[model samples]
Target: MQLIIMRHGEAGRHSLDHERELTEVGRKQAANVAEKIAQSDSKPSVIWCSPYIRARQTAAIVGDILGVPVKEKSFITPDDDPGRCLDALLENKESPLMLVSHMPLVGSLTTLLSDGHRNGMPFMTAQAVVLDMPVVGPDCATLKTQFLP
Candidate 1:
């Protein structure tokens, strides 16, 4: 299976963390990444996104460009456990899955899957890392490439 782990675009600060919205620059960043993905062979069958506004917005852009369905996964939230998120992803049968989420979770998930360790990667806003995995487990995936916008 191929997994694309993406961090949400830059967001404006809000009193409610979940309510923070993407900035104009963030939208442009998402658009740039979406265009890049659309030109690639790695189209996602399904997209999973955090419920947070910024992540959802980013996922929407990708899903629209890729013509894939997007679903909100609570486990992909910023502070959620990477192990649990991995387990949830493993439950899906879809290949070429995409996940739009926040930092720490995005970076940690990539590290947990690629290097068998958490916090091994630090992702910038609007960055994505692709992983090819035969099965879901620690260190089971190889990094294909990273896309940054």
Candidate 2:
């Protein structure tokens, strides 16, 4: 399985954290990353993203570019537990899966999948980490490369 863990594009402040929307620069960043993915062999077959506005938007951009479908997942929010999120991901049997989410979760989940720990990697907005996993579990994934936009 190939896992593409992506941090949502930069977002403007909102009264409600869940309602935060991507800024203009964020949209460009998303598109740029999507273009990079489309040109590479790592394009995802499906996208799973946090239900938050910014994450949804980021996923939509990538999905549109790749001509894949996007699904909103409630468990991938910024503060959601990485282990629980991994459990939720295991329910789906899709290869080349892309997940769009926020800072802490995206980082922590990447580390959990690749290192068997939640020490957490760091990600910039609109950045993506690609992992190759034989199975979807802790320490099962190998960090392939990262796409920066």
Candidate 3:
């Protein structure tokens, strides 16, 4: 199984967190990243995203290219622990899964798998981290590819 964790693109300043949509540059970034994601030949079986508009919008971009449905996974939010997030992914029998979420959570979760340190947390807007592993625990999803948008 493969897990593709992507952070939402840049949003407007002072906008409502749930209502924030992607900016013009963010849209382009998502498109570029989507292009790269499509090259995988193995698209996500489901595009899981935060209910937040920014994340949903980001997922929609790649979903357009991958032809995957965008389902809001509330556990991808900032305060949500990655355990629930990983559980949701594990429950899916799909080959590749795309998760669109926030910054610290994405970075922290990645660290929980790749390394023990969170000092190098860096998930840029529209950037994605692709992991290859068994459909098991969070530790199983080792970092495979990091895509910058």
Best by lDDT: 2
In angstroms, the error of model 2 at 63 is 0.9
Model 1, residue 38: distance off in Å is: 0.8
TM-score of each: 0.97, 0.97, 0.90
lDDT for predicted candidate 1 compared with the true structure = 0.90
Tens digits of lDDT, candidate 3, 28-110: 88888989988875468888899888888888988997788888877888667766766676678866888889878888878
Ranked by TM-score, top first = 1, 2, 3
What CA RMSD would candidate 3 show? 1.8
Candidate 2 at residue 117, lDDT?
Answer: 91
Clash pairs, candidate 2, are: none
The 10-residue segment of model 2 with minimum total lDDT is: 84-93
| Cα-based lDDT at residue 39, candidate 1 | 86
Q: Tens-digit lDDT track for model 1 on 22-43? A: 9999998988898888888778
